[model samples]
Target: MSAAIFHNPLLNNGPDPWIVKQSDGFYYMMVTAGRHLALRRSRTITGLADEEPKVIWAPSSPGPYSHNLWAPELHEIDGTKYIYYTANDGGGDDTRRVCVLQLSGTDPMQDEWIFKGAVNAEHPGLDGTVLPHKGELYFFYSGYGHFPDYGSAIYAARMANPWTLVGPNVLITAPTADWEKQGGMAINEGPAFLRRFGRIFLIFSASATWSDDYCLGLTSISESADLLDASAWDKHPGPVFAQYPEHGVYAPGHNSFTISPDGQEDWIVYHAYDYSEVDQKRSESRPRSTRVQRFGWTDKGMPDFAKPMALDTPLNRPSGEV
Candidate 1:
């Protein structure tokens, strides 16, 4: 199978992309901003760029998360599909809150999303990712405050139910290293954890999300170790993926991974900026745009994200007739 090439800013004004492969044989994706939560679906993974995303959920009142809906993710657990996202009530950064909603139909497009309320936790949270590990459901998100410096850290907890946390949140990773210190902010946000080749790998977006230095960092835990243990996970010491020097793509982070139609290939869907000067502040130019690329496994069985390809280039499709 040949690799496919897509460009930065795949969507006009989208950011914080979250993608899920639905049982109905379509790729459903969502992003932050614009009146409501935008939903996109496509039969082919690469074809998503051409599909018109619809607002599945919107804010009715003026509040912190009312206008700025960010990082919306869809997960199907125990025969029910749930949309997890972040928003603010008063239309500012401080009011940003993580919330969840229930989708009515089996198919994401035809379904009606109902507000399910916020997931209970200690501090304010954003970028919620729901992952099931070993028969137990786990929620991974970014936590603020606790650290006197006001840096964001990755935290996780068991889920008693799909929309609720079972216990206190556990701190998994923080911005203690140089790689995570960029854009003048000690930050660790946008966490996505996966197990491959007997190792539990947690990939996170690091650096100041608003700066061009925004990149991805990796941490790992042995298959035999407890994932909730902070000591069990080892930080990679550097970024797994970041901006492309020659391609002019910058601030590439907050990504989601999914399999192709045949279910044999791995692809990453993320947002990036075409211009280097666009800071993290929300704007038309800095809108989180979606892009996709083939993910290769290294000799050690970990993801080898050497360099992201240009979004406008065309490459070979994954194996299996697509």
Candidate 2:
């Protein structure tokens, strides 16, 4: 039989999409569910939308981590599953911080998710992600800091464990470029690690997510370099991925990377608006749906995300789909 086809906007109401294909030969996905963390599993990359999302974790009462849950990412370390996400105490943006959850039991859907508490307690931020290298763990997130302007900037700290951040947090990248300061905010958030050709690439979202100008930025450091050292990273001057107005795609940001089912292809899962319908009433809570498309690596050892595709475009499914 011929391989099945897929389209953009895999889900109509998913933002900050995070997906991981595990050794069990299944793809698990998690996105921003506002008040709780949810999980979906499927055999194919495009099948995640068809799976019923299981509420793996939800707050029992209003507290520090009881409101504004966003960007939930699932990662496994030493045979245990942990989720790193953003949450707040139902206050303003300053209360937003990265929190973690630990899993008990074999399956995520049937397991109990225990709160592990906030990371980097002194520093309030959002969008926490993990990068493991050479038997060490590094945690990256968008922390509330001033880069000559009061807004969020990318920060990194060494992880003592899945939920604890050790040492001082180092500033990685800031919103200095003109493109990074759009929609009345200067921002550099959503840091995701992509490793290729023995180098670690830091891909992050820039500008305000609610703005049509929201896009993706890039930076990198050699695998052997000290990840916590801010000087060791080389920041890209321009966005590596941005809106494709001709294709009717807008504000693509907060991305995660996963391999094809057969582990032969690289795919990017991100969230974007279907069209430019900006209004005075717009906010981050606006429905930004999830999308996925295969990306290619450059001969010079870099990622080429190309341009965002239109929602109606029919594309071949990921290679080796079951």
Candidate 3:
């Protein structure tokens, strides 16, 4: 039971981080590294530091996605590989949109990634992620609302295929709580899905990332209910994960989850901002790092996230891994 306990900030300056266990038996990580897209692969999450990031794709021509790339996520659907990300040219929100890249080769690093165009949200949007439940594929993402203060809100629709949108964008969660409004933006974005106990929980980050108050909130829908119906969702009252300023961990949101190698334990991977830093402007300049912690379920089968663990304390790795 005595496994190695690694430090927090697993990879410094890594924000909007996402890790997926693919068919290759390796963990693939994607994060916002400024303007271009990059990927890191490792047998274990702790081993990620041993490997240098492989720069997979950078736009060669100048256009809508030529600059400011953020929140890149990778997925393999059917037999093809796809990547979802947000970017824009210098022309402001008009150019900012959710775009995708498709790969022909197995290895994303060595493959030729073809531009697949934007998700066609009809409004300014970002953080596009896909989830397939039952027999339908749904595309979930964050979009700019009509109100200026509604910097972003989570929305989704059934997808006809990987890159094609089928239904109208249904608004899932808008920032109605005061905790969600920070740094002038009432935001709810960075959605990740966890399906269990006959329910689908859409866990997402809320508030501005630039602010330390940035955290996570949860909304769920019954598996038997109509997922496309906005009225079917049950919104949690507050954030499931938030700042632990006493432990020097702040803005602990924007998360993704994966099961253990033996499929016995569930682990959640996320990035957290430093708490001691006072300068909000310069604080964001410091790189956010990726961390993982074990999470469990309540008696009622809801996710028991508890509290954000202390930063400096060492914790054991997930159940069964070398």
> Which number leads on TM-score?
2
Instruction: Return the TM-score for each candidate structure.
Output: 0.91, 0.96, 0.95
Candidate 1 Cα errors over 4 Å, as ranges: 1-9, 63-65, 91-94, 278-283
Worst 10 contiguous positions by lDDT, candidate 1: 1-10
Give per-residue CA lDDT, model 3, range 49-128, as digits (tens).
66889888888988878888989998988868899999988677667888989997888888789988888785688889
* Candidate 2 lDDT over residue span 1-322, tens digit each: 3448777788988999999987667899999999988999999999998999998888899998899999999998888888999999999878898998998866877878888889964568899998888898888899887445848998888889988878888989999999999888999999988888888999999999878989999999998899888999999999999988899888999999999887899999999987684654345555899999999988888999999999988888998986
**Candidate 1 global TM-score:** 0.91
- Tens-digit lDDT string for candidate 1 (215-275): 9999998878776887888889888999996876788899888887887888887888777
Please report the TM-score between candidate 2 and the true structure. Answer: 0.96
- Model with the higher lDDT, candidate 2 or 3: 2
Candidate 3 local lDDT, residue 146: 81
lDDT of each: 0.78, 0.88, 0.84
Say what the RMSD of model 2 is.
1.8
